[model samples]
Target: MSGKPGPSAAAVLPELPVTFRPVRTRVVLLTVGAGLLVVLTVVALMMPSGGAQPWGPGDRATMIITGLLIFALLAVLSRPKVVADDDGITVVNLVASRRLEWAEVVKVNLRTGDPWVYLDLTDGTSLAAMGIQPGGGRDQAVRAARQLRALAEARGTGQPGTR
Candidate 1:
């Protein structure tokens, strides 16, 4: 046996206990992108003008650019997620990720006409939970929000697994 000692179980980090995300955000994004591409291809093929000039470089370039932009939008909108563990919670938004302890969190709520869930913090600042949106799968988002609140309360009360 080697003289080096192997890593012990005590040195390993416990897995985070909670994760919340939109149910079918990625699926909808991918489906839209693929569906757009397919429709575009079919339309291009069915163009009455059999001549090559109708589907020139300019037309192809425009389609490519439009598809790419749509995909980019999907990428941005699909980025948000929320995760919680023994330590605290991490909120990943469209363009930013913030980590905060349980004490920093005030509440999670969805306002009327709000596109997504909002996380109110103790510091008077609020973060958008873009991962939980009212569209596509409202039930899933509601469940996720409830789960997040329960997790926060459970871990924020200074008693682990007590709630």
Candidate 2:
């Protein structure tokens, strides 16, 4: 018999499917900016004028510019990405990225009435894969969970009922 080692378990397992969805950074930035603007406007209105105008052209311009900046930031931050495959899963956080192997994943749970997809791992950990859900509805979240489950099954690591 040949002395070569047999195929490793990883090699026989199916490759994990990889998928990604960009987060909506603009929306988040816009929401934040609007909130800040409202607060600032309220504060300006509340303060005593002391015989002076509460807001001038410069102030208005600043607020407008700042609001625009906030919108842009939100748009950028909201751009969450999802990457899944038979091997593992990956999620791009607000400013960083993380990955997990299929073996490490315990189960896939789609939170009902939630805006994102959640993964429950064997280690009693969970992760949120965002950006794929449109309108923050349940349908999209369910679809994502199915996709993750399918990927896990392909790798022979998913729960029995998940298949």
Which candidate number has the best lDDT? 1
lDDT of 2 at 156: 38
Pairs in steric clash, model 1: none
Candidate 1: where are CA atoms >4 Å away? 1-17, 41-55, 111-114, 157-163
On TM-score, the candidate that comes out on top is 1
| Candidate 1's TM-score | 0.67
Q: List all candidate RMSDs to the true structure.
A: 11.6, 10.5
Q: Write the per-residue lDDT of candidate 2 for residues 57-142, one digit (tens) a residue.
A: 56666756776676556665676777876456787766777788877665555544555666666677777766455444444445
lDDT of 1 by residue, 87-161 (tens): 898888878998989887766665556788887777778788777777857766665665666555555642222
Error of 2 at 24 (Å): 8.4
